[model samples]
Target: MLNTSRRLWNQFFRKARKVNNEPLNKVSLIVLIVVDIFILINVVMGLDDISRWYISPSQAEPCYSQWQNYRTKTTTDKDFEIIKNSFFGIDNPLSQEQIYQQVEERHLGKVSQTCFQYAKYQEQINIPPNQQIIQNIEQKQIQVSQFEQSNSNIRAQYDSTLLEKIAGQSREKSINVVGAEKAKQELDQNNQRISTLKQEITNLKNQLVTKPESMNFLGFLQEDSNFNQVEVNYQQASFWYPSIQLGFQSLFLVPLILVALSIHNFAQRREYGLIALISWHLLVIFFLPLILKIFEFLQVGVLFRFTFDILSTLLGGLLFLISYVYILLIPIVGFGIIQLCQKVILNTKAQAVRRIQDSRCIQCAKKIRTHDTYCPHCGYYQYIECPNCHNLTYKYLSHCHQCGAFQESSHNHA
Candidate 1:
């Protein structure tokens, strides 16, 4: 066992010496590192492209604005019905166009005045400080107040005059009079004006609430039933999403694993020859960029989202819960599994023997090892030292006294 271990150790140190001493071997190591870095960069860029594909520019996104418009139009239609029932009443139902016209006429003068005031304020900002900007603003404020007060006074006077005329008509001996009809007509016109103003105010407020700019993706998905069709489309797209993403991932990760294994092999074989090290590193460098280029052809994230949408539909809310839990636990579970394998299955004598024969763990085929009852690194048992020859021999093999000698079995004469 001692002899076998010494031989293996000697071999490793000799390889290390060649790798450290030879200029060509050192150059290959440097090339390998550079290539790994380049491959890593490409992987990052590919991931970014995938993200962009999934996220999509807000302006260019299909169905988003149309959904918003749909909401706005529906809201407007509902408001039309409410206004018709509340103000126009069953006796005199109004068309949408007629309601719009009445509302516009009711608010036209006031809206125009407000717009003029805003325009004047804009002009004020452009004026020089030497000019009476402040004084002009103050003057406009006073004028607005006076104008409102005067209109109120005029309305009050008209109301008082109307009441006095109605009272005078009532005082007549006979209740039936010519002026009563005129008074009734005047009151009816006044009530109609007030109703029009109220309806106009209600419609404007509703419009503000139902505007297209108010909705967002999450809110739309969560609350709005109108987006169900769009959601279904997305879900349908998701079916192919996983395959595209996995393909891209494999493109980069498979080569990365291969390159890493090659580097490890180069480290071991460096003692044998610089030619092996250089050739292995050359292969890694040659393939890394090619693997990365596959990303250019893949829209991984977009595909993923497309698939996810349908998956969500099929799985419902369970999909979201599973995804969340999986994302949170995958690393932890993976690390625990690795640790357990190392401590249990990989740390056996059979595994150690395989490692000695193959220069890698039999179970994983990823890590290198040396001869020992149990590997010092991986804790896998390999060979036991012969008591006499002090050489290594397989633990499971049967020999007379097990001297660890290389010999063929003979048949006993009967």
Candidate 2:
């Protein structure tokens, strides 16, 4: 069994080495390798793009982090300030009362907008009552938006009028008294309009909360049902995303590998060197990404998550110890694999057996006569006396060829 396995490995290496037998073929192989690397990079990138089609946790629930902070009672005034500034793009420093008001307003607006979206999503899936609730929220939101826009316009006009009034007063000694008086009247009217708009906007916002359907939607957001479901779905999608990407990448490469393998096998049978070389390159290109993605999946997919959960549960505060454990364990594991390969898989005895079977010196692999006891090239012993048969047999072979007696020393060496 070992001899058969060794023969297959030797044949594979022999064919691979033959692929670049000539100088021109070597250059062609290098060019094909460069092409393969380029294709592999692009294939990996394409897989990444496909994986992003699923919604991420942050995208699915934009306010989740803030909501969590709020729920945990860890939201400080600094957090509210940051949120308020971000929402309104505020650059100027605000007074304490102004900061509080702006933060409260921003929070309400965000909640309302999120709830409206949730309602719309539910309505799209034909959920009863959500359609009516969505329509009501949309109407109220539009009204609030329009009022806010008008209020901004009115404030801009009031500021202009007030500035004009101050200029007119400054020029009162040189200009007409009538123009100064008119500027003052315009400023007063603008101020009154600004006050009225502020009242109207406040009234509209209050009315938005008063509506039954809108109130219910707001209540839903407050209760965390909508956000919780989205969070759960986002987590589930994230957990499976790596596996999905690996599956898709495999699907893409598997067919190419199969085709290339078939071509390679056919070419080898027919002694079509060039065809076999190209097919071998194609097979390697197709398999490289698959092997890389499998490793990637093992690191980041559900398997990793499961392993992480177990470690977290077991180690708790001692989780950092895992790094030290891996640092010590990996070298030991690698050393064991190396020892196994040296002792059993690719041992020197296995190579000697193949060389002996081909009538070559076991030490130098140079041509030798069947009855030669020592290699002429290397002066290494080619045969040893088998105790059971008292006959010379090839060194490193498990059994004596003449008497079919087991060579104990040869078996030990193997």
Best by lDDT: 2
lDDT of 1 by residue, 1-414 (tens): 354346445544443334333444576657756765775577667655543343222211234344445456645454323222222222445533344344445431111222233223223222233123333433554555554554454554555555656667344553333344454565565556555554654554444334342223223333565456444545544444445454555655566656755665555433335544444444444455544434333234443355556668778877766466446554565577557754574343444355446665332233444443454433545454555576765553333235635423211100
For candidate 2, lDDT tens digit of each residue in 1-414? 476457547645554545523323577657876877887787677767655544444444455565565456643333222222222222345533344344445432122345246434323322334333334544655665665665555555555555666766454453332343454565566556656655654454455445464455445546786577656655776687677667767777788889998898577545577777778777777777777776667667877687677878889988887667556655675578657866785576787777777787765455779888777755778777788878888777878988999876774422
Candidate 2 Cα outliers beyond 4 Å, as residue runs: 1-20, 25-30, 49-203, 223-237, 326-414
Candidate 1 backbone clash number: 10
TM-score per prediction, in order, is 0.32, 0.49
Error of 2 at 352 (Å): 12
Error of 1 at 154 (Å): 27
Model 2, C-alpha of 339: deviation from truth (Å): 9.9
Clash pairs detected, candidate 2 = none
lDDT of each: 0.44, 0.59
